[model samples]
Target: MASKMTSGDLDEQFLTCPLCMLHFRDPRVLPCLHTFCRECLQEWATKQQPLECPTCRTQVSLPDQGVDGLKTNFYVNNLLDFVAVKKGAGPGVPCQVCEGGQDGDKSWCVDCAAWMCDLCTTVHRKLPGTKEHEVVPAEVLKAEKDVSKFQRKRHCHKHKNQELVFYCESCNALVCTACTVVDHRPGNDHNPVEVSGIADDKKDKLRQLLSHVDPRLKEMQDALKEFDKETMKLDSSRIESVNQATSYFQHLADLLQKREREILSQIDATYRGIGRTLESQKEAVESGFSRLASARTFCRQAVDYENEMHIVEIGEQAQRTVEGLLLERVNLKPEQDKVQFSERVSVTDFKNDVERLGVVSSTVNVDVSKCRVVTKTPVVGLECTSVLETADEEGQAVAVSREAVSACLTGPKGNTAVPTQLRAKDEGRVWEILYTPEVTGRHRLEVMVKDRDVTGSPFDVVVRSRESAVITIGSEGNEEGQLKKPLDVAIDGDGNVVVLEQVNRRVQVFDAGRGNVLKCFPIDNDGLFGTGTDSNGNLFVTSFGESYGIRKYSQEGELLATFNPEYLRHPLGVAVLQDGRMVAADKQQKSCLLLQPDGSLIREIGKGQLQDPWFIAVDQSRGLMFVTDNRAHKVVVFDLEGNLKFSFGKRGPNRGELNGPTGVTLDPAGNVIVANKADGRVQVFGPDGTYLRTVTTTRGAPHGLALTPDGYVAVACYTGHCVELYRYK
Candidate 1:
């Protein structure tokens, strides 16, 4: 059974041509069940190599006679006739063939294309020249279905009473039967065929076209689903990261509140002390004024006595009393109060010790070199290299290898460094970049292709300090003058090496003359880690475990003062300048602190730049410091003011490379000596961070390094059982 068509369906399917979307005129049908106007098909065929159905893109072999050779849709012509009659029946329509009076149309002549009453249509049919003309009853036309497919009359413009019946293949035009003999017959190549012959073949081709479109549509749908899944994952990750950040900042906020209370209490105590002293001074001045008032009253009463003798006797005593009171007032010296309060009091230089406060920052770092890569998965550590492809306006990949790809690295100190090597692979679609970073903390790695950022570009690389030892020192033992798990080393004024061993809590002094033990002393507590010497031959040491402070000692091992500042925690490296200033690197604070000789903190340097600074060496003449950042795999140089001059070395096993570098010092020539604990080698660099040479290639986890006055470098090896001394210039 055929499905019933509504008014809307009839309007779309029958009333208009598929090609021109207008009322059908001379409608022709192809075998594909689609219909177009004769003129539209002829024009469309001329543009195509082989005629094709415009709706389905089906290829068609044209009849030699062109468009007119196709079958005409007669049903469409009848529908058009019905619609015209219906329109003429409306109130405004008038008969075109009427002589004077405007008569409503009752019938339509298909050939003459005239609307007339019953009289006109009858007359038009009876005329000798129009007797064969086709006329339809106006009321009968209203019963027709499929009126949309109705075709309108199209007659030859030049010839009278002739219908266009044939097509000219050579001229690609439609013509009347008379036109064939007059215009088209002159050409023998004008091969004409009936239009009905090729209609079935064209329809079959349209069915084949649908097969190619189905799979491509399915692929697009699948891609959209995958894209939605990835988008959801990205949103979930963003929410999780926000929650973690909130928790971390809450912890910092608590710490800040505690510090705020402590500082306020100090301010209150200062105010109370000054207020009490000022009150006491006010009381002393009031007492002196009362004595003078009593003296004046006594003198006035004596002058009121009745007898002259009485007056004279009382006057002398009164005079003496008043004079004594007046003299006492003159003799009294007022004490000016020296104590005063300042208009405003503040905690200046609060960052003098980093451990006293918390640092807030919003930077997040990820080290690409340490990131793991999954097979057949999107790139994680660095940006995905796929975005380098050329894309269309809709962001779909269109072409590959559209531009040159490049990459650069910027260190934590804002120094931009070009990659040591950058090369493309996989037909210029993939790139490999190599660079060495010099500073610790967050570094930025950027990849660009054609002046555009690659996917997930500008990766944050968190670089850690290197930990390597150059030479080995004393072996582990419990005997006197023997080292056991030594943690720190320092050089004395007399060129003796001071070593602090944590396991046995012993401090051993080794004589540089024969590399023999000179003296051994025991510390009361354990966890001692850092040591240094002042210009006056005073030794300073820092302990981490039970006793957490810096300890000072005389040359003869006599205990001096222990400085336990509230801001010093987990101190690892200590250095003494020629001006009696001390610098200590605090591991917990991740900063280096400068202090006075009395252990009062002056300022902190490299609060965010130094990561786990373990050992330090001072070049007094050059006013510079060399520090080994144990976790960042670099040696950082700084001036006394804590400004970073430069830094060098990266984590690796090769020469001039540092891995777990722990011990650091400077030679007489102002060259840097570093100990790599991971590779057990000593690498030397020039003052400007240029690799000079290697000192010792074999050692076992050297932890502390010290340079003697006589040009010998002593290393304290934690794992190796012996101390090795090398003379380096």
Candidate 2:
């Protein structure tokens, strides 16, 4: 059997039971070493008691309950079924497991746990091992108690194979034959019956209940189905709402994108404009710095040129190059007096340039094409715009001789309204400005244009010029603060400064700082043309006040008496000599007057030789006096003893010409500053009358020139509307 049966591999190990004849879903090995599927054993042992193994003919005890391991083995059996083949068919037989002759019977003994027909059961009953085993019906071994109550297991109530038979409805239990007859009696209120009848009755009642509930139950289910459909619709609506919100989100995103582009454009434009302005300002600063250095070098040379007068000093040489190198000045086109900042200062690029130039403040980008002004004349009534550009703080060192020019304007209206915008007949367009200033100076012409759409573009107008050397000290205006003629003014030895107004009063003492009225001392009748200072800091004002001579005052409103110098008609200036002597220039007589400190008369400038003598200046060190004459447009030098030394200056607007010349003063440095009125300028001269340069002014009236010991030059800007004091380098 081992060789012919094939020495098989591990796969062919399972066989079907001889009784049930089915492969195992859940295979189990019987105690007799015979195998059976779990469900096959239950069917085979139906109505059997103390069931025995079919293969051994041994009265084997069968398990009352199914084993859990075999039940879970169904999954493993599935794997086996794929590889296994069906077994050979076998002949029908009785139990095939009984040891006695009953095994050959026509019926199986299930309750006795033996395979025997009715004939063999009798013999098996007497067998030693099976005598106590109960007998049961053939092929009906399944007992009521041994039947599976649930899906998992089945078991007998007592012995292994005799399944419980009759069920007692009165006790709600299943019982064997003895229990049925004994426990259940007829009509003693005990109802006992076969389990099949109960099962049939339950089935019939359940069927009736189902028949009654179907339609209504289906109606409720249909209602639930409709509610589910409505819920799905709402879900779709919610999704659509969310999608709409997403659309709005997209819209806002687009708006923000556009806004960002606009803002970036503005930023780029602003920076570009800044770059241009910075370049211009940097040029100005560098030029100024270079000029300053060169000018200082020349000034030093000039100062040292007087080798017989003063000593000089120089700085030490450099040991090494400057580190971290900011603010180093390099010579660019050195011969042309040009230099550059170490780095270009560009707003857009931050790079600086080398040439000197001018930059218009963003506030005052005037339309020069629309403006028409001339020498000695001013332009007004023009509208302009103002946009506050940043200040070039580092570039402020640019030298501007602005306080020495007198500027004023008259218009058809009241005081000109200089607005922040320009609205004009030309539709807010720019006009060309033709400025013909009477003097050479730095001027700013500001104009603004406001359009119909209320939109504006800031445009810049530039007027770049080399600053002139001028030193004007007075201006002209109508007496009631209106337009009128103006005259020379001066700060005398006293702090009391005075000006010749176009008013009837002729001379007004506007406070030097606040421009407030001090006193309008009328002196035209006295033919007064100049004012002076004495050793005591008193104002020895030479006016035609008393007998066409000079008068003296103690600064604190005191009348210190007057002088009627002999041989003097109109005195243009008065001065105090170091030794208490008085000097006066009589322009009407073309001569000088010398007075005793005691109000007595001394000598004269030849008692007759001078011409059109207008102003008197004294060189204290030389003990000499210089006088400017309008008739000759020349200044004649005179010794303290009233003797003419030399003469210079002219009537033209040339280098030394004194056009409408007025006040004059000798600076402590022996330099002479003359207020040239008609020229609308102030000119500087060397001690020997050499034309140095022009002193310019920001305003139109730098008429009276006074320098404190500390170089503070005060100019009484009379009709120009204000008085300003400037510190000179």
**C-alpha lDDT of candidate 2 relative to the true structure:** 0.45
Q: What is the TM-score of each candidate against the true structure?
A: 0.35, 0.33
lDDT values for all models: 0.60, 0.45
Clashes of 1: 39
| TM accuracy, model 1 | 0.35
* Residue ranges of candidate 2 with Cα displaced over 4 Å: 1-486, 492-496, 500-526, 545-547, 606-608, 697-704, 708-728
Q: lDDT tens string, model 1, 1-729?
A: 123222234344566887788988887755343568999998898888867778645466666787887756554555556566667656566677774225454766776656777777778878987877777766665664544323344456677667655555576455667787776674676744332333233323322332332443344344444434433444344445444434433444544456544434423332232233223223332332333343343232222212222222233333443444344322122222121212121234333532444221110111122222111111112222212232222232222232344566666676666343554444333344645545556766676543445556676755533332222345667887567777778888787888888888768888765557888877776678888888898888888765888898887778899998988888888988888888888899998888998899998888889888888888888888888898999998888887988899999988788999988888778888898988878888988888987766555578888777755567777876556676453
Model number with the top TM-score: 1
